[model samples]
Target: QEELAKKQAEALKIQKKNDELRAREEQRHLAKNTRVFELPLSRYKRKDDLKDIAACLGLDLNGKIPELTSRIKAHLDSNSVLQANPRFCGLFG
Candidate 1:
């Protein structure tokens, strides 16, 4: 029915609005709570930066830049160290 369709459309709109608001809040939360260590691996452009991150993550620092990056990524993925926030996980995972 036309009435049912109208109500459904209205409900969908409301749901979408709520989803947007929740996503915005999540971004704010992540911005406030994110730590330096949670930064994406790509952000560490320099080898030294990656080395520092690897050291902090207790990863082996003996490899090349790409190797180190991959190792760190693998460790994070397997351990779920950044599992709390899926948004943060997407940044690096």
Candidate 2:
């Protein structure tokens, strides 16, 4: 009975150590893959700056800006041409 208890205690310790190692490895992997950006859009001088940033992050910026801008203006204008609105407001909002 004593030998069986000793074996069970050793197994528990080994399992605990393995769990700790796995957690540490996962934390390191997450830190390596995560990215954070800190900047206000108003700080950018031109629309191309946004595209360049996206490109640097391995994102496809082609045609996305035009589509996004048009969609936003369409929403704000309610599909009417009579409304006078800013072209870059949608980009910032």
lDDT of 1 by residue, 34-73 (tens): 3355466677777766666665566676888889888977
Off by over 4 Å in 1: 1-35, 85-93
For each candidate, what is the lDDT? 0.68, 0.49
Q: How many collisions between residues are there in candidate 1?
A: 0
Per lDDT, the best of the predicted structures is 1
lDDT of 1 at 28: 42
Whole-model lDDT, model 1: 0.68
Q: Where does candidate 2 stray beyond 4 Å?
A: 35-93
